[model samples]
Target: MRFFSQRRRPFLSVVICIHDMAREAPRTILSACCPYQKNVSPEDYEVIVVDNGSAVPFALRDGAGLSPAPRIVSMPHPRPSPVFALNWAARHVARGNHILFAIDGARIFSDQLIANTLRAHSICTDAFVYTLGCHLGPSVQMVSTTQGYNEDVEDRLIAESGWPAKPSALYNISVFAGSSSNGFWKPIVESNAFSVPRQLLDKMGGFHESFASSGGGLANLEIFARYVQRPDAKNVCLLSDMTFHQVHGGVATSAKVQHSTFAQEYFSIFQREYRFPSFDAIYLGPLRPEAAKFARIGLAE
Candidate 1:
């Protein structure tokens, strides 16, 4: 009745970061996920959920019936940022060389989620691997709720993307149109998935500790551009396999705005301190990576 295959114990660490989750939301997530964990045999993996400062009611403990009994890593920051929460939780926990960050609000659609991601990483030429991130429809409340199977459900944006039907299925997608969003991945923290060498966390001196709360401005993107976006980076590949990320529009908009402003201001500070040419040069490189084959010519500028 456990999730995962009983015969095989895969090496993986599943990290879920939670903040300001409503009373029912956390239970809802666990309820839906528990069955899948049982069906999939969760013996091989470790699940760690980090509780960031939350304004609303929170369990402060794992809800009853939370199968696999995920470890509760507490971040008592009265007002901690999501980036900080994730970094704290991931810093010393999870045993596998592969680390996955699943948003607390996102439901695990298939038990095969972890299995497929690892399979992709095994074959990837790079050391780090990225799964095609997709949003699960709001109606699905648990992993068992996941129905139907479609490999091409999502369009492939990266050449490495593919459709595989195995222990699970994930629509190959970039959460924000292939742009990075806080979601799942292995060998990298959820907040720093786009970075190469995975160890960039220590190299960058860990998440910008300056920000009081969420929105560590351009910190995430800066790492991505410098580490993962480079053409020569190796051992990293985005999984085209279908994994479902539940979408409930659950993130706190008020909190999100506060962090956005903070992120923007903090990023500007980096620009000023570094004398960078343009904020876009430092922040939104997606718009214009100089080496991009599709760069705009003079008139388009």
Candidate 2:
């Protein structure tokens, strides 16, 4: 059953990949849908969620009652990596001229994400637009989990933050991820929420399928690097908007013994396949007072 249908093609297609996130998917979907996402109409974008072979598959009801409800696609035989699923969705399911990937489905977006992304696209259609990522705790989840953080703790944190009503409050509760800790002026290793023109994605072949590690390894970083390094692609970082990640026991974000092992493996694969270069971005979006501290984090150093 299709949850979304529009007369005209949407301007942006949001592709979100999930694996065993039944408890967290609903909130993530809501954060990306109407009402929660301010200033953007349902017709402006379409969300395509790929369930990468979870033990309990994600259903349509997860996004029930949401206008432009996410179109959930389940993979029957999924691989350890999400790259295959992401590529399939981008090539087959997406209908937008620009594709925005929230590769991790556990992220909750800032309200102005969609609207500001559209504004950035208007400024430069070929721009590679991305938002810095943050974790819903005192520190990054990998470290926070060691400090007694979990899904329950995250829920309480979100509840206390008064989000949706006070979407900007997310900044108050979240600390920037290590990749995005350097502030908006510096280059980030990767972005949890990022958009690129469909053509540019196609040119790069929609994420390398060889990133066979459980969480697509460093595939996200590779895509960001490729897009920013392109001479034709204008990298735009949204200073006001961000994606707040919930604790979901992810390969990289969770506190597990395998975390360091996975990191080394992924980095080795990345080094063997491509180079990791620091590429500066053209900062965009209105810097909200709530977000100013994060945006200027390392600027004085």
Q: Which model scores highest in lDDT?
A: 2
Model 1 C-alpha lDDT per residue in residues 1-301, reported as the tens digit of each score: 1112223323555666666655324533453345444334465556676666656535535556555566766675635456566566556555544456554434333344444445544555244444333343222322212443122231232123422222232332323212223212222222222222224334434345455534344444444433443344443434323234433333321123444564455566565432211111112111212112212212243
- TM-score of each model, paired residue for residue: 0.54, 0.91
lDDT of 2 by residue, 1-301 (tens): 2223343568999999999998778888988888888888889899989999998888856456676778889865689889888877877788888889988999988888989898899899788999999988999888889989998988888888887678888889999998788778877788999998876776665677667888877788887888888776588999799998989998888744364565576667656544555776788867889898797788788
lDDT, model 2: 0.82
Winner by TM-score: 2
**Number of colliding residue pairs in each model:** 25, 0
Q: Which run of 10 residues does model 1 get worst, by summed lDDT?
A: 276-285
* RMSD per model, one decimal: 11.9, 3.5
| CA lDDT for candidate 1 | 0.41
